[model samples]
Target: MAKTFAIVVGESSGDQLGAPLIKELKKRYPDAKFIGIGGEKMIAEGFESLFDMERLSVMGLFEVLSRLPELLKIRKTLKNHFLQNPPDVYIGIDAPDFNLPLARMLKAHGIKTMHYVCPSVWAWREKRVEKIKKSVDSMLCLLPFEVEFCQKHQLNATFVGHTLADKIPLEKQTLQAREKLKLNVDAPVLCMMPGSRQSEIKRMAPLFIQSVNKIAQSIENLFVLIPVSSEKREKQLQEYLVEASFKYQIIKQDSISALSAANVALITSGTAALEAMLCKTPMVVSYKANALTYKIISKMLTIDYVSLPNIIANREIIKELLQDDATEQNIVNAVLILMGKNEQLRQIELFTQMHRSLIAQADIQAVNAIDSLLLSK
Candidate 1:
């Protein structure tokens, strides 16, 4: 008899994590069936996607509220489907907003539940710990710090390390990356990652472009590389690019190459900042949200920094400018500071250490953890 695994992943980063795990799981259970929400990568690895992953890829409290009806509809559909035909194990790979409730409901029905990428209980909504205990049968975490946190809370959690750390090399080939991207080897390169989502690009692109304009005025030949996550985002950024007066190139769906080739980066806070850190690129992280959303969520945050690099280091390794503070002037100042040799070298040294701590053969460990959960059942 074969096993069935239902995995749900909401965004691109989750998809990246899910794809490799699916491949490894397939190798372990040749006849296993995987079906759920995922992006291109997971689909390519023979996972059946029930819904377009983008439907649940929303961020910000206000944004989620706006789409609440639709999101609820999808969740209800998923819940009813699983109730009718439950898999052996349900793996919710991030998207805690949607996944947690779905996992809890399925768990009540006696289906084993595994949640990959533990939500930031240490950061905010510590009350979520109680819900997580009730919802997840086993939790697989990416950060080293999270394992201890989970243990303290008496949750069954395993640290699988970060898949990005496994994929990004310790010594990045910047020169070769520049050459491959047809960029000038000696010129200053700035990777502008507004974000992967349409809403994020809409909020941050203009601000990043304005900041780059300021930097361009000072630097002789600054080259900007904007990595668009999709054709829709490319077109969305193109609309914003029409107003820019600086030299820039748009590379579709290749954030790693852009990060590798960058001397510094101006990124909207999220996984892109983490990717920038892995590439050892100095960066100034910035983010914006709907005004009411920022006000409400900001009050609940327990941590100081937003970027993963800073959060992992437990210090302000990278400057995080948010909401009102994420101004053009602030971004320009941060970028200029990063342009200095001493600052760049310090960041790179710290980034190398962070990278070393996170290389833990994630896919294999994740599968092993999941297998343990299955055996206990």
Candidate 2:
């Protein structure tokens, strides 16, 4: 009989990361039924999605609140369906908020569960490690440190490395990206990515655009590339950039290329900062969140660094200008410094070292972990 693997992934990044695992699993079990919530990439690999993946793409605390009923209904529906006919193993990729509870429900009913991508328990809410222990049989972490956290809690975990690391070249591969983007390879090019989320765009766009405007006023012939995740985001960023007197291009759905092509990147914190690091591009990571949220989170966080580049190195490799310090002057000075060959070379060397550490056949590692979980019972 063919095995069944139920996989749930939220957002495009999750989908991108999940696709390779699904492909590897298929290679091992040709007739296995791959079903759950996935995006286009997973669909291309013949995985069946029960509901529109966008249903789970809700962002922000307020946005999730508005969609709470629908989200709950979907989870309940999945819970009922799986209880009636459980898969051999269920895997939740990212979306810890949505996936962990569902995994917990399924696991309680004697179903095997695994989660890809460890949550932010390392940064804050360390008690969540206990909650996660009850949910999944194992965790497939993208970073080495996450596995260390999981080990401390005695949670079954593997450091599969980051899919971004696997995809991005280990060596500095900027020239080709610059050529493809039709950029002046010698001239200073800056990538300003505010982030993909609606909440991120709203909070950071003004600050980023104002910074770009001020930077452009002082610097000569500086070209900016802003990569938007969606058409909606493109429209939103266009409004912000139009008001700013800067030479910029609004590109859609090509964040990695933008990061690679630029001499220096002024970006919002999170995956993009990681991506910039993988691209071997120097960057200044910045973020601005709601005041009350920041205040509460500031107290909760255990770590000093925010960007993954800095966190991975266990030191401040890149400059992080966050919240109150994320001003135009600070960004301008940081960007100027990063544009210099000496500073750029320093970051690129460190980035290359980190990248080398992260390119460990992640897909195979993830599937092997899943296979072990499947075999245990």
Clashing pairs for model 1 are none
lDDT of 2: 0.87
Best by TM-score: 1
lDDT of 1 by residue, 1-377 (tens): 89989999988889888999999999999999999898888999999999999898899888888999999999999989888988989999989989999999999999999999989999999989999988999999989999899989999999999887898899866997898899999999999998888788888889999889999998889999998766777888999898787899988767889999999999988889889989999999999999998888889999988889999999998999999899999999999988998999899999999999999999999999989999995
| Highest-lDDT candidate | 1
TM-score of each: 0.97, 0.93
What lDDT does each candidate get?
0.91, 0.87
Which stretches of candidate 2 lie above 4 Å from their native place?
58-63
lDDT of 2 by residue, 1-377 (tens): 89999999877678878788888999999999998999878988999999977678766556677899999999999899888889999999999999999999999999999999899899999999998999999999989889988999999999999877888888777798888888888877899988776668888899888888888877789999998766776887777776778888877777888888888999988778888999998999989777766787789999999899888888998999988898889988888778789999999999999999998899999988988998897
